[model samples]
Structures are given as structure tokens and as C-alpha cells.
Target: MNIKLLSGSVALALTIGVGAVPSGASEKPNVVLMLADNVGYGDIGAYGGGAMRGMPTPVLDQLAAEGLQLTQFLVEPGCTPSRAALMTGRYSVRSGLGTIILGGLPNTLQEEEFTLGEMFKSVGYSTAIVGKWHLGFEEQSWPTRQGFDEYRVGVIETSESTLYRPNMERARIDEATILEAVPHIYESDGQGNLTPVREYTLEYRRQIESDIADAAVNYIARQAAAETPFFLYIGWTHTHYPSLTAPEFTGKSTHRYGDAMMELDHRTGQVLQAIEDAGIEDNTIVLWMSDNGASPDAAPWPDKGGSNGPFRGELGDPTEGSIRTVGMIRWPEKIKPGKTNEMVAIHDILPTLASIVGADLPDDRPYDGVDQSAFLLGQQDMSKREHLLTHVNNKVAALRWRHFRIYPKAYRGSFSNPSQEGLLGVQVEKNGGPDIFNIEMDPREEYSISGDNAWVVAQWLRFVAEYNESLREHPNPPGVTLTDPDFGK
Candidate 1:
């Protein structure tokens, strides 16, 4: 079953064919949701990034060209909000993930809200999530209780945890802990408990320990024959700040990021292969998108060479770079195979998938996300969501309506990274001050001008106050804004 390449084309030929469906056509397609951490837009081949100045991802490009490559996809300005949106299909502030999730804080994604994993599993799809999950860490909100049949990876401390072997470099890329030879550990009982079961040092090592790809393949191999369909949400912690590389991938590209990108591509190919090998490729929907923009675009490391391509803002800044990043979906049986300029928000995935599986969401909860099922099916004219909201923990907020991105005047900077691409950025500064930039027409925010647009900015500020008021009404509201004693005085 060799995939015959043309006379001259790709070096490693791949046979893309799926003939196994477990005799269940009405059982809904198996879904694989792949999420990237802190990856920029132009790093991949499918996005018109030339190899000269960009990384080459043939496998990813092939996936986009053969599926749905969303050009205007947007997410939260940081990892937590972006993840929260992907899981609940709700805005970050509404779900209490407007800021990064760390520092042993009890505040996490509320258990009351339904996650995509939980939603799909309830409707009979065997669900599993592997890789970085910054949404929550406590038992109440762990992946096991959230509907995953199998959870392989730590629920918390992944951003801080790194591995080599026993008595190796206690040097951590994020947060350091004393341990040994821990590569891929599995958490059973719903992330309540964990144990180490496997370790690979060669071909599989790069995909497993560093990429979160092998566990995904294992899940597919084990369930490819099951009578029930499956939903696998595979998240990878690659290209994120404090970037580490597998030994083999260290010098794989011009920059450290290139090696990471190549490693990600191999992982992508593996997941696709798992589906194809199981003969479920034609019957599965693969949703892939980055969480946010990039870190330097948002925080302390602005010199990291992370670019938002043509995006104005970087990450937490409310500019296009901050919110808009990579998004694409592949489904042979559902979505149209091509590219789309149709603007879509990051919060639209939840209800859309729920419809496909015929699942019911909580009746009492109000979700700000609109179901873009029609848009997915090639019927473009489906919605009129006037504006998309951009929220920073306390620094700033805005209403994004089409080309006009208006913001509140006299607003402090955001606690989230300045850019939305998911790069780590400095938090709020004590010299916390007011600054303004026309995000679309002027992105760098170099020229601060709250003077000329004072009137319009004032109106936007009033709207932000009202938005904050609504958040306060929630059971778990966001942190207060205008921290100093200067708000009311």
C-alpha cells in the first residue's frame, strides 16, 4: 500500500487512505482536535510563509489546503483565555480565564461550564485529551471529571516541568521539580492520580516526550476498531516560551523555533497517519488552531523573533496580532476543503461541534459564542455577530466590530501579554498608565494618542464599564480593574 509519489515531489511519500469505519455510519465522525501552544501564523508552509524567512511545514500545509484554512481566526490574547475559549466556546472573561492560570491559584475554569471533551463524551464519543492544559488544575475541573475516557499528561505544572532522566539537569524550562527519567506520564482517575508507563529515546521520543503526539497515536490505534466513535483533543506544548528542544531536533532549523516547528510537523503527520492507518481518516474531523498570537508580542521577550505576520498587535494588545492567529479544520465528510476569508471568532467551536453530535448544552447557561455550522458547510452568510469582545485582565478591553476596532480611553495596559498569539509577556506595570493606538490602521502602539479620538474613546470606555459590571454579576467574576485608589477618587 505504498503511496506513489509523482516523478518529482515530496521525499517521504505518504499514503492517505481510510477504509475502516467500524460499521457505524450514524455514530458521528471521530473528532481529533489538535491545538498548538504559542505558535505564530507565518511559521507554517500553508500560510504563504516562504521557507527563506519562515519554517516549512509540508504536512500542515497539506492539511490546510485539503481542509478549511481560516484566514481570520481569533483567540484570547494569552494561553489561559485561548484554552478556555476552545474548551467552552465562551469568552475568557465570562469563564474567568481572562488572565494566565498559574501560581497555585484556586481560581480555574469553573466546573459548572461544559467542556468540549465532556460534551462529546456524553454523546457517546470516547474522549481523551493529551498535552498542555492550562485551563484548570484542581480535581473539580480536571480533565478526567470533564469527560475524558483517557487522560495522558499532567493536568498542572506542565509549563514548569521538563524531563531528561534520573538525576539529570534540575534545570527547568518553566517551573522546576526534582524527579528523574520522566518523559510521558499518564494521569488516570481523571487527572486525580498519575504514573509513568512508557519512555522512548529515538524516533518516538521526539514525538512523545516533547510533542504529545505518540499518546494520540496510541489512542487512535487502540480505538480504531471500537464500535463507538471517538473524540481526541491533542494539545502540544511546543514553541511556547522557555522553549526546549529534543536532542535530535536541536539544530534542525535556522532557529530553535524552526526545529520546534519541524518537530510539530512530524507529530502532525503521525496523528494523520494514525487516523489513516485505522482507516478512519475519511470519517474524522480534525480541528487545528493555535491558542493565541506569540509571547514577545505580549511580554518581556520582545526580541524572540516571533512575528504576527501582518497582524498589528502582538498578543495581549487587542490588535489583530493579539487576537487573530492560526485556524484550520479538516473533515472529509463535513467541512468544505479550501481556504476562507470569512471572519470567525475563537469562541464558535463549541456549539458547532455540539450540533454535529446531536448533543444538548446546559439550558440555563448563556453562551456568547454563535454556532458557525452553516459557515463550515460553505453557506457563508450565516451570522451577524456585530462585534467581538477583547478583554485584558485589568489593563484594557474593547469591542471588535469588523474593521473598526474601538477601545476605551484612559485605560491601563493589560495583565495579559500585549499580543494575542500566546507568547508570554510582562504583566501589568505599577506605573500603570493610559495609552491609545488605532489597532487596525496603526498597530505598533508607538504613538499614544487619546486626544484626537477622545470623544469616541470615551463612549468605548463607558461600554467597558458596563461590561465589567456584567462580569461582576457572575458567580465567579473577573478580578477588579483600576487597581490603585484612583478609580472613584
Candidate 2:
């Protein structure tokens, strides 16, 4: 893996072909993008789990029935990377956020990177993000600084930080010291100033989703009343580690994970109901999706984790289960309600939404996402995307071209160290060249038909080669890794 550090400005320009909004499309639709944390492909009822997984998601299932359900929606392998891809419409590596970010790290979303909030705001839409903003804690990377008009009821870190104080107490740490270091839920003043609302205790964690839902619902009502086209991003913290439910939903399901799932469904329903009450259902584009797949580490916990359907790998692994998760988009009369197996990725959302709202994308840098507005609006049956490169950190781990998944390196996991699999598994170099699996035929990737599908490898290599060639012109910024000599410098 030859990782080149990005230096100076590189003229690796890209031209994206975006479809125009439909004829007579007068009103720009309001967008509500809800991103779930660590929910899997099989976590929801719509994707064939729900009741079977001991958690019934009726709201999500109904949303799927009333809109377009994606069977092959893909994302990055971790939380920060997935969010970066969705916000920038480019590979997370381009923004130097190719992996999960740790606290006190210098790695942050740079101010120069264009975000979805900035893009929507450029088109005169009022934008806000309510909930998890894990990109960075720096003021430069704050949601307000990134072009959002408002940032409320959110955390700048992962949900697991809620357990920090408890874990410190168990280790017999000093109470006052622990209190000083505890994470807090924050609210921003539409400028770069952030105010801590409260300590993110376990009790608060249980009801955090409810608070996020409340803020988002209230924002929607206000925006609707003001008659402003709005882009509301609701980041729901549920089904993540330390899965806890509010008092109302504590025992509503079979287990901790089920309870959390139920809470997630209810909170999501509350936001959707707000949209309906505002009478903006017809002109509102609602997208419900999960950040990544389930964490196998959660399986050993009391919550028992989530189901990645029949897919074999867990969250953060460069496998189908890690990248392929639930995705649904609803726009009453504009987008037809139907399910499709056509591939669409997290990075595609920015360009697709830009196309739908008639916004222009900046052409100075390269973007991995193509405009899928035509396919999304039912103007075309097939998706515009045909290939997606799966990256683990700065390295290209795998390639998905059409129905084939080609892997230049194989992932091998051991029973003694299951958690290590999330870090792209213990990579093993294949001596007989790359392994090719027909994803449609073997969704679990149990068999490698490399001998039979030799031609597919040649085609997949071209995609990889093209990506590498682009990197030569526009090299990626240094991605997070454990082996960097200048650690935390």
C-alpha cells in the first residue's frame, strides 16, 4: 500500500453529469436526512429482521413501503468515515478522515472541505444538524462553522462516551477529576460558540434520542411555518454500545438492543409525524439510513448486538455486512415507491440531493459520487453507480463492480480475537492473485469463484488502477493509523 501524503494544490479536476430537476418542478423539496448509529442491514423490519431480531420497526417499514427501499445501499466501514463521505460526496480519505476519530487527535474535518450543509445553504436553504457531530471538536469543524444555521442537542463524540464516568469509577478514579473529564451534551449558537447543556450521563444517554427527536421535530415545525426550504439532519444515537432505552421504553422489548431499537423507531416516527403535521409530506424528501453495520463486539454484551442479516462480517470490516446497510428515501409524488437492488453509496447522497434541488457542485476537486437523481426520482430504472471502492483507512481494501466483489487481499479472523476483525480483519496477501466473489450469487461471500470468473478480475483491476492514477494527481491527506511515528503531534 503506497500511501502518498497530499501536498499543495493538485489539479485533479472532475466533471460530474447531474440530471436536471423534473419539468414543472417549481418547489425545492425540504430534506430530512436521519442517520442511525450502528444499525445493521437486518435491524429493521423492512429489511427482513425486526420481529425476528426481537425488535419491530413499524415506522421504518411503513416508510419503506411508502417510498424507495434500497437493497444494496453501501457506506464506509466506520462512523466518522461514513459521515464524512455523506457530507463531502467524496471518499473520506480525501478529507483525512478515513477512520474513526479519537478524542484529542489533530485529525479533524478541515475548514476547506465543502459540506452538505454549505451546499444546501448556498442554494438558500436553511440547514441545521441536531445530534452526533463526530467529525471533530474543534471550532473550525463545528456544525455552525461548517454552514449550518443551527446546531442543537448534540454530542461532538461517540455515544459510548456516556459510559466514561462509570468506567472511571469502576477503576477507582477520583470523583472530582472524573467529573472534570466527563463528556457533555452541547448546543451551538449558530456561530462557532458551543455551550454545554448537561453532562452526558447514562440517564441522559437513555433519553438522548428523544431529545434529538424533539429538537428536530421543533425545527421542522418552525421551518415549515416560516415557509423556508430546509435541510434538517437528525443524527440518532441508538443501538450503539451501552445500548440503553428511555424510562418509557426500558422493558418494551426482549433485550437491551431490542429496547433501544424500539426507542429508535418511536423517536423517528415522532419526527416523521412532525413533517406530516406541518403538511410538508408531499414536498419533503425524507432519507432514513444507518451509518454502518452491527458491531460483533456487542454480541458478547447483554444487548446481544444487531443482525447484519446473512452477511458474515461485522462493522468496520471491509465486507458486505460492514458496508451494505438499510437505506430508504421518500418524496411523496416525486419519487416512486418501490424497492431496487441497484447499488447506491453514502457518498452519492450529496450530489444526488444537489441535483434534486438544482444546486451546483464545486468542480475544483474530485468526487467519487455520481448523480443518482434520475434513478432516485424514478426517471431511470437502473442506478447511475456501477462501482464502489471499499477503503480501510488510506488503503483500497476491496472493489465492488456490478454484482462482483473483487478482493486483492483476503481477511482472516481468529476466534480468539474477534474484535480485531473490525480493523479490516487480519489482512493476508493472496499468492494466487485476487479473489473474486459474485455478490448476487454469494451474498455471504463464502465461495470465491476466481477460477471461473477470471475476466471480472481484469475489469475490476481497471477501476482500481484508475483510482490509483487519480491519487497520483490528487493524493489523499494522511489518514488515521496506529503506526504513525508522529503520534498526536
Local accuracy by lDDT, each model: 0.64, 0.83
Residue-level lDDT for 172 in candidate 2? 97
**312-388 in candidate 1: lDDT tens per residue?**
55665566677777889988866768787667777778776775666667755445565666667654553324356
Model 2 bad stretches (over 4 Å): 1-26, 174-181, 298-300, 415-420, 483-489
lDDT of 2 by residue, 380-449 (tens): 6778777888888578998888888888988766446444466535777899978888887898899999
